[model samples]
Target: MIVLSEESQRTSGKDAQNMNITAGKAVAESVRTTLGPKGMDKMLVDSGGSVVVTNDGVTILKEMDIDHPAANMIVEVSETQEDEVGDGTTSAVVVAGELLDQAEELLDQDIHATTLAQGYRQAAEKAKEILEEDAIEVTEDDRETLVEIAQTAMTGKGAENSKDLLADLVVDAVLAVKDEDGIDTENVSVEKVVGSSIDQSELVEGVIVDKERVDENMPYAVEDANVALFDGAIEVKETEIDAEVNVTDPDQLQQFLDQEEEQLREMVDHLVDIGADVVFVGDGIDDMAQHYLAQEGILAVRRAKSDDLKRLARATGGRVVSNLEDIESDDLGFAGSVAQKDVGGDERIFVEDVEEAKSVTLILRGGTEHVVDEIERAIDDSLGVVRTTLLDGQVLPGGGAPEAELALQLRDFADSVGGREQLAVEAFADALEVIPRTLAENAGLDPIDSLVDLRSRHDGGEFGAGLDAYTGDVIDMEAEGVVEPLRVKTQAIESATEAAVMILRIDDVIAAGDLKGGGSDDDGDEPAGGPGGAGGMGGMGGMGGMGGAM
Candidate 1:
């Protein structure tokens, strides 16, 4: 019979629960202060001295390098929230920590983990229902409302100063890429370039090629461009198997070179015959072919990346042709203009004013690298919220309005399900108030007073009322133009509840011994009957020795 050794470390019941909850709360505390519009930023430095400064929840948690399995689960909650809604990551983590906190209190009162898990799951379902019922419908033509949603997302971020301009650009970019099927964010590209003011950022009606013209002799600009997307290289292809030609006479070698040149010339002749004014080649272009194309007054770009080629095809209404011999007039793309311009000592190609482009480009300009990066993060948040809004066609008031309303409704729901589970449900409701409380605290206001006022106002039929973290005043979020997509709140609640339940369900933890250096003391004294001692067994004998000694 196989016998288990008593020397193995095992933690169960209250000990395991306490340890997991402590680790989760510690992680939550690390990011709690970075919650609201007035939230402070965290500067994380790795062992190698690399630094990252931001208030983004997922970024901060991901950089922390958490070790505890339970804590990592909390981090996953934030990550899942960010992946699903693209915002409210901090709120999700904070709520999850609070749920565990409340669960600990219930555990002290002899409440089973299974009971707590069931209540939390039920509360999550009701919270999602509340969010959907409270959402305000928005139409595609509501440009003003859409702009407000974008501005609200960008507020208190690096892009606040230019939020109006950036919001307008974001709205236009989303609309430009929206089709009958749905909105595809991949079609809207955001390109960041430093050394310019933010106001200089503009939207291009087509794709922006980051490369320069292939030949210097080619025209700088081509109007009424007929673009051809070549997936193959312009150079002559060698045979599949290697073979060398031996020519004893110099005339035979010259003839071989002339034939290669003739092939390149004919390739260029084919392009000119098909009325191709510009070419975007996915592979290298031979020097001879470049010269011939330039001589024919054709614009060409070589070494285009596959992603850029795809975007070009979408913007120009063309297909990527793999074989040059199969090139036809129908395979070509139409563009109003294709030009090359030099900015900051770098050449960039612009394919602009396509006939009916489903893809658009937003060029972001800033004074420095750091500024541009922050702006990109801000714009990313804006774009995500806009896309969510367009897809769901529903939105909720921001600035903690949804949380306050949800809390009030959930309390009444708890009363209906009166039992031990009712206590857990009520705890879930109280946990949600963390959002507004943190917002108030971050804005330098009295959290207790703010919560009281918010609850009272919400109870008095002011469903849209929320704390304006900027001024610490209770105002109607809708009237103040503070709004967010309904999915953000719903996603946060669902993820936080699921994580809390998963952690609460754990009742036992068995940790394996460290196997790297073997079980030896710092004094270098081996126990009696250990592996090298009287017993012939190795590590297993050491375990028996430890049990006997203890």
Candidate 2:
């Protein structure tokens, strides 16, 4: 209509649905290959020439600069999964995409979008119940089970070759931070050092400050050191308002300078009086203060991060004093040894052997930057899963066992539902099989063959049946030490179903302006915007290989 703006464009009915579904599915396919232990990685490079080589689903999706509305929704699924469990981001997105695929098929059969959405919602609720029923109960006190959970999460990741070592460290770190309130993963900090291999990573009894002593004249190490943490600077404070000092004589100017020095000296004196041999300053330390600190034989680190200060307080059983005047003897934390060591040609401060430290750090060593980075990501995911397992108090068999089990149960559920919605439910059941199928496909196994094998096993009441990607065999995932936090699967199913249902119910798409159509330069084909190279979603022009991920 002439009344409409020139830039506004709209597509209704089937065309709109297909265009949306196609974009969403394409986004899913982009990250599909990077799933499972056998999955490949995607190297994402930005316009700034920064490169990220990771198989992690959320990382890949986040790096990609997608603009398509439908495609962006798929990315949200990954984000939500990551936020909830810090694991299974890929699985969540993949499941959502597959759900859309299934919905498309049902739509082709003349099943209304409302019917599909309703069935998907029902199936999602039932899936969570099935997951809960099949889950194995776990507790925070179960160390062995927790270790296995950590190892399973790290499986097939970059650190898998040395997962045994890292898993032990992760489990220990998580357990160390676990209190009556539950595990606070933030209490566990990871410090990366390039030189040693991944297996060389160790759980530090205390914090590692990636900083050196403020002065070289100070002692490199202290035995049974008492630590002091300050949120304020050790420098002389200036007047809040601008004021001109009337110094009529040179002696008066010298007196003003001496007063500033006295202030800095007093701050250092307070630490010495409190028997503090080490100081971590959140803000800058004045040059004079450094001299005083070194003169007092105290190992002081300036510009320490606030987080490090908090962890230091936890490790040392000390307080982070905001003011020098307020500091007391009890404000000091303890470390068996605080030393500055040269690591990989760089100096770092280590606060080690804190007695019964609630805060612990993991020094992750690797051969190179990329290696260390991948290790950090792997351990991060592992820690998250282990912590989540402790929090949820339940877990499910991994390696697609939960999906396989859920699919079998849903079929039985679909049989009980009446009306045309039953077909939607059945289709949802088939969609759940995509996980196991993709797992087999990524491992170079026959998808159909694996599906049949899984279905046959589940038909015989083997609820724990799953694909062992390494061997291309169907086996008991739990017995094989392949388990995942129950929240991971539950959240993935629920989030995916909601996303899929939302995308499915959209029967119309309207842009702010008369949107141009997306086209291919090679053959000038519009595969997505509208039917057969027509006008529609032009803003999605770069989405085909968007973010350089696809």
- Which candidate number would show the highest lDDT if scored against the true structure? 2
Q: What would you estimate as the lDDT of candidate 2? A: 0.84
Q: TM-scores for all candidates?
A: 0.90, 0.94
User: What TM value does model 2 have?
Assistant: 0.94
Q: Model 1 segments beyond 4 Å from truth?
A: 1-10, 511-550
Candidate 1 residue-wise lDDT, 165-258, digit = tens: 9999999998888889888778888888888799888889899889999899999999999999999899998999999999999999999999
Cα miss at 233, model 2 (Å)? 0.9
Consecutive 10-residue window with the lowest summed lDDT within model 2: 529-538
The TM-score that candidate 1 achieves is: 0.90
Q: What lDDT would candidate 1 get against the real structure?
A: 0.83
lDDT, candidate 2, 422-470, per-residue tens:
8888889889888999999999999999999999998899888899998
